[model samples]
Target: MPTDVDLGHHGDRDVAPGLVDLAVNVRAGAPPSWLLARLTGALGRLAAYPDQSSARAAVAARHGRPAGSVLLTAGAAEGFVLLARTLRPRRAVVVHPQFTEPEAALRAAGHEVERVVLAPPFRVGPGLVPEDADLVVVGNPTNPTSVLHPASTLSALCRPGRVVVVDEAFMDAVPGEAESLAGRSDLPGLVVVRSLTKTWGLAGLRVGYLLADPALVARLQQAQPLWPLSAPALVAVEACSAPSAVEESATWARGIVAHREHLAEALAGVPGVDVVPDARGPFLLLRTPVDVRSALRDVGFAVRRGDTFPGLGPEWARVAVRDPDTSDAFVRALRGALGQPAPAGDGGRPVGSVALVGGGPGDPALLTVRGLQLLAAADVVVADRLGPTTVLDGLAPGVKVVDASKTPGGRTVPQEETNARLVSLAREGKRVVRLKGGDPYVFARGWEELAACRAAGVPVEVVPGVTSALGAPAAADVPVTHRELAQEFVVVSGHVPPGDPRSTVDWDALARLNGTLVLLMAVDRLPAISAALVAGGRGGDTPVAVVQQGTLEGQRVLRTTLAAAGDDCARAGVRPPAVVVVGAVAGLVAG
Candidate 1:
């Protein structure tokens, strides 16, 4: 068993910037727009003191209990604290691998807390619990393990003069709310603490309630501070308890079950990743190498650690079951972190289609919504050096990564071979993502690959991304076009020298224009191109700015005139994958 010192540690602390969150198990997106509107409407009422009666009645009605049987608290966590303060149990027993707040609360109030650590499968049995324990706290569809104890097993723990607290914070995520005691009013000493936070995506609002005997509810209510529930929280309590809200929750719960099963199956197939069987919660419990969590974090993923829970070790982790796309992305990251090979799945079905996804400049955050979705679903990701490869760190387990970077003067995978690989993978029924840097169409020869795919009769989807030619200037606070400074902006490739017969850009015409010139793939040719502009009637003193690896952590920005732009870039050894801006707007540094 692990030490109890960090029993209070929660999942939120595992989250950080740029990481795909599997640590916190809140709903995927924001609270629904209607729910947001409801919360927003309640803000105007904050001037008044909280009125708990309406919320109490709503919750009671939702649970099919008397209004007197409900006691609203700041959240389920606060309800645990209240129980610790109010109940004077002769023996306190808490189930292991469950939410730790109840046990922590008990210990804080000077009670010697006993832990009944369940073994694998984590099912609660009569012999496992202490018969003499007067108080027991457990989570239905328990956290970190996602095991749902039968309601009958919970009822058996309710002895006379004893209080049984069931934390069902995630029960709503389980389809049918199976094995949940939230609506059970016939049982004695059964206190069901329910959170509106997870299902409503209102963790910040802190609204929850406990359902128990009216007498016990009154006793717990006595321990609460005056107006413990906020006015807006109360409104949430009421709104979420409405019949329509309950129906919507049930629908989401069903969807969650499907997503969880899909995620679990995929994870189970990954080498070195084990999904706990019969998981019924919104999150899945996984067992892997002890170092896997930190490794995931290093690759832009945040996953909850399991060591804080008693009976679990450093090898354990909890991952929220999200939509299929995100689940796919997460699984890929897991496999990459573990260095595992692809899993063998059913061979009868045709593999999925392919998408040429734009990875968007150098920043993973700039990936388009559709691109992210397609990337998540990809079974094989053929990535480029210029694309945001960090996102590949979040790919689902069993995903194959093919490096297709076309480095000049360096050994690289031939374009034809890459195209053939993509077509073959798609024909084999794999969801393939040809991830490229910036917008695939912006000088990426993506149209050529798309043409090959169409010729081979392989289905393909093109998801556009933020081009660095535009993203770079914006990142450096240098606008390509500024009002009264530059009226138009042209983005052209600098891969070919100005005098090269293959070059399509007319240097003379470009120099004759007064608009901005944004160049991509031009770092190596900067000197020739700058001189060509100077010789073609363009002013030698025209402002020029070079942004290298723009929007990335190692991004660098250089400012100089057109005459010195090429010479200065060469002197500084600026690399390719750089964006160059030339025009009056380049000189207009934003304040």
Candidate 2:
């Protein structure tokens, strides 16, 4: 650790004027537009003294508790200071690698603070703290490490005389608030402080609240001034605590899970970067070998230094989760900072190069090296739902991910719109990658994207992938072409029924062929296609194989005869995105 470290140093200090900021845990985008409007409306109330009652009731109701049990603070940090000023503890223990405000507050108030630093993975337990300590403060889904402690673990810290304070400032970003203790009123001497700063982008307004028994709330209240929160801050708190706002917060939390996963995987891919595996917070903790924070700043990124946290050293850093584009950009900068190979395109500055990159099947490792390189180098990626999503997780955080997935029976973006988006992005001098599953040319619409880019004067290149037509069959151990049973093979789409006007497949010609037949997207129309083959003189007992979600963890394979393929598929509840093979060779492999 550095000797010149400031114990009070925070993420805000790491941020500069124009960097891709991954330092502060504050939400990336602005507060909800409606929230801002509410605050704007409250501006008229400025003439009045601060009224804390309504906001207090709203917070209480949101937590399913009485109004008396809640105490609104300017922020959770202020609540820590109030606790320090009011509570007189003989032995105070502050958990390390957590938010420093509580411990800093206690120390400033002349209390001797004992540090309880948990090891890596940083989960809290009852045995780690001294039984004699009368005061204990810990952060749930703690800072820097982003580990969410179980509610039972926190509850175990409570004793008759000991007051356990849980900082749940980031709990709102956890889906379902699963490990939160904020709503638990049965625990003895437990105080939960929550902040709206992270989820609602309200750091500047400083709105937060404390939940505890009425008696403790009164004691903490005594240490505060009368007009602790301004009028607008009060309105902000009440407005955000409403039912609609709570639901929106949950949605945001769910989105954070995806963003965090995307950022974590990218960071993990970089050499010398070690990401904590159990991150549930909206930020990630990374440890690198060579002071990547300073190096990152040189590459236009500002990351929070972790040395100030008692249990962390200089090699560690904390980064906030951002939307995909910002995340991709940060990951690219990080790779550059770490001295990794420069991404493709001139001098790593992506120009008008459009890469029709194959995402392979469902597996990330199946992606060709060049395809992965192009992905990392791309400024924009228009992705399909069935593409190698695992590869997306490994992309640079700054890459723009445009979901052009055409989900069946669900809303889908038009192909023309996706084409226009790719061309427009390329026109803006971005390196755009039209990422698709399997081989981009094999039933994945690669040529359409290629033609669009070519017409738009964008330099486009295609990186072929391992097509699932063969990959899925091979994964299921079914050979599309066998030495003795089948001499040739054919692949066709079964997305449309046999008699549909859009259907071009020659079922009779396919049936007469003495070889294997591989059908893609054939699950829904399997029954119709199988009957067509049988009626076209294909033997009823010809073997059939259905492989669903092939090459993935939940993959399933079913074996039957061509005559019963449809019934068997229906009986087994087979779904789309499956491959069906019919021929004598289909029986060669065990399902």
- Give the top-scoring candidate (TM-score): 1
Q: What is the alpha-carbon lDDT for the whole of candidate 2?
A: 0.86
Root-mean-square deviation of every model: 15.0, 21.8
Q: How many pairs of residues collide in each model?
A: 13, 8
Q: Candidate 1 residues 1-591, lDDT tens each? A: 236548879999898754667889888667998888887778788889988999999999998999999999888999999999999999899999888888888888888888999888888898888888889888998997999888888988886788899999998998778898888888878999999999989998898999989988888888889999888899899999999999999999999999999999889778777788999989999998646987787655688988888888888899988877567657866887898754554333464677998888889999999998988777899999887999888899989999888898897888889988987888788889999999989988788677556434456788898999999889998998777988998998899999875577999999989999999999999989999999999999999999998999988999999999988998898987799999998898655
Q: How accurate is candidate 1 locally (lDDT)?
A: 0.86
* Candidate 2 structure quality by residue, lDDT tens digits, 1-591: 123446789999998854556889999767989998898788788899988888988998999999989999998999999999999999999898898888888988999888899888788777899999999999988997899998888899987899999999999999999989888888989999999988999899999999999999998888899999999899989999999999999999999999899888777667778898889999998888778887777655788999888888888999889876567667777777778875453264543878888777687878899998888788888889885887777778877788999998998989879878887788688888888989989998777777565444456788999999999889889999978999999999988889764468889999899999999988888889989998999999999999998888878999999989999999999887789999988899463
Model 2: colliding residue pairs = 327-397, 327-398, 328-396, 328-397, 328-398, 328-399, 329-397, 329-398
Cα displacement (Å) at residue 94, model 1:
0.3
